[model samples]
Target: MSKAHLPTPPDFLIKEFASFQPKDRQAIAIKVAKLERKVFPAIEHFNYDVELKKKNIGMVLAFKEDDTDTVVAYLVYQRMKRLVWLHKLCVLEQEREKGLGKRLIEFLRTQMEKGGCQIHLWVDSNRKPAMALYKSCGFQQIEYRPDYYGPGRAALKMELSIGE
Candidate 1:
């Protein structure tokens, strides 16, 4: 499909990826696995314990209309102290560059404001596109590590103080 064919998320659509459920075990696992493959390919396996904890945490999943709804994007986060740590943000290949990421981040900031936390996330150093997107959204890189993502993959810790 052409770039213009990318779907715009609906204004009436809700912004939340209700945490995975035991009954949804298979579906959630498949979705999460696909996400990890495309986004965290270097990681051999996901941390199940941490993922289980994420079930109780807040999240957002953006869906676009099709014959049946399809998840176009998603965000996973948790609060630590006064910081809102975004653990994951994924937008399908077809959905990228359509401004869905911007809307998702803005929604996260609003969620942080209501919860009284500042938003932050750990980004891979080489992900220039993600860094640019975060920068455009007012996120500043506050820290960096030479090999934070294991082996040669480095990381940039970014923060966005909300409701200030």
Candidate 2:
């Protein structure tokens, strides 16, 4: 990705959910899990209980500045040295087109740049809006895998190099 600046949406406050108290984090996890099921296909849905316990995994959630308890969007990623794998990015259906997705990507990029990490992800080819969002954040297409999702669905592998 280019070094161009990416602006965060001012209405939403995004932060790593790990910093919260165990009880609060558990509450957010339940909401996130429910949101994931509503937004993502079953094939792509993750088990937040198991995923949240990983040391390498990180979850960034976006909440309305006025309402810290409700999650409006989220981005999940795994970092290992200079490589970061972006696992999932989702915004509640009612919250789409408000730049939440790009904001989350920019947030991750800015944080990972300190360590010169390269972010990688495979987006389902059928999701045009998602592809556009990532591309807008300067993610370059690296490869295309046919039938990666199923018999007809495909996947596009993309990457964004941060300060590398």
Candidate 3:
């Protein structure tokens, strides 16, 4: 998809993941891990430590309730050289279709632009919603691999350039 086709997200609050409160972090982790298990059971899960140690890892989180700070969405990416690799993006099942995912992508794009980075991500071809989301966020499918996850499962490699 072209950059002009992407939809602009509505107003939303996104904050760098700095709340070290164990409970808060654990809560977000649990939700993300659970969703990952449900959506991609065959994939290896990323523990908090492993995720945080990636080169230039940046985590942005979105809250459902302003007063309570309950995490409902998150985007995790790692910057290496001039490229930003999107590691994970998750939104609570109940909160889908509310544009939280797009908001997370926008936040990531803003950060990457500041550093003149291009974005890369891989998604299962069968995951229509995720594929659509990435395409709508200006990622072009650059490659396709059959059986990427396993037999009968294909993956699409997508890329988005934020700057030269």
Best by lDDT: 2
Candidate 2 accuracy as lDDT: 0.88
Residue-level lDDT of model 1, residues 33-54, one tens digit each, is 5665775565544553357446
Clash count of each predicted structure: 1, 0, 0
- Residue 45 C-alpha lDDT in model 1: 45
TM-score, predicted candidate 3 vs. hidden true structure: 0.80
The numbered model that scores best in TM-score is 2
The per-residue C-alpha lDDT of model 2 at residue 8 equals 58
Rank ordering of all candidates by TM-score, starting from the highest: 2, 3, 1
Q: Which sections of candidate 1 miss by over 4 Å?
A: 1-14, 19-29, 42-56
Higher-ranked by TM-score: 1 or 3: 3
Give TM-scores for every candidate, taking all chains together and pairing residue i with residue i.
0.76, 0.92, 0.80
lDDT of 3 by residue, 1-164 (tens): 33222333443456666434655666666666666666546555777656764548877777644433466677888879898889788887877888888888987787667657789998889989999999889999999999998899899999999966
Error of 3 at 33 (Å): 3.6
Whole-model lDDT, candidate 3? Answer: 0.75
Residue 3 displacement in candidate 3 (angstroms): 21
lDDT of 2 by residue, 64-122 (tens): 88998889999999999999999999999899999999888888888787858799999
